[model samples]
Target: MTSRENCGYSSRTIFAAWVQGNFRIAAGCFWNTLDEFESAVDESYSCEAAETYKQAARDCVAELTVKLNKAGE
Candidate 1:
């Protein structure tokens, strides 16, 4: 049988998907940081920039928890 057919929507599949989605979010955050670094001539007043990054990180964690809980059912 194929892998999916054998596993049949197992928790492992759910966890893997969750991890993949989180990784994509992290990559986007990294790119955002790089973009800011290249464009920001002065690093002394990057409070707004830091806040955006922190929000994105929080969102990713929240999403991951939701997905994992849903998968448990």
Candidate 2:
């Protein structure tokens, strides 16, 4: 489960959270998914891979942050 295919579980969690109007839960799911990705990168790759995955994770968090903020409005 080290491949990108493993990402679907956490990705699905994010989608499920968002659909349920749970932005915080969605953000948490993103973090957990990113952590799993980072661990995988650390074991089989270099810092470059970790950094790239981190960037994508950060982008996801950023989007979730926006949604969360808007929900408060």
Candidate 3:
């Protein structure tokens, strides 16, 4: 929720793994890029929700909370 203060960050950012291991900035994994996430989203998955695995990519700088359109803009 808050920066460590010693991390030398001027902005607030929260990084979470949520039981995921593979992490990177520009990875093909779900968390990294939307294109990659959408492309790979066709695959069948069980147990966890799609949103759970659709979080930020591993080791990225920060995530954004933008206002999306109801009609997908």
Best by TM-score: 2
Considering only N, C-alpha and C atoms within 3 Å, which residue pairs clash in candidate 1? none
lDDT per residue, candidate 3, 35-66, as tens digits?
45434533533325333333332112232212
Model 3 ranges off by over 4 Å: 1-25, 28-33, 57-73
Candidate 3 similarity to native, TM-score: 0.26
Q: What digit string (tens of lDDT, one per residue) describes model 2 on residues 1-73?
A: 1112222324332321233333222223243444564565467545775565455544555666575564454
Which is the leading candidate under lDDT?
2
- TM-scores of all predicted structures: 0.35, 0.41, 0.26
- Steric clash pairs (candidate 2): none
Instruction: Quantify all predictions' global Cα lDDT against the true fold.
Output: 0.33, 0.43, 0.29
- Residue 2's C-alpha lDDT in candidate 3? 11
By TM-score, the better pick of 1 and 3 is 1
Residue 30 CA displacement from its true place in model 3, Å: 8.3
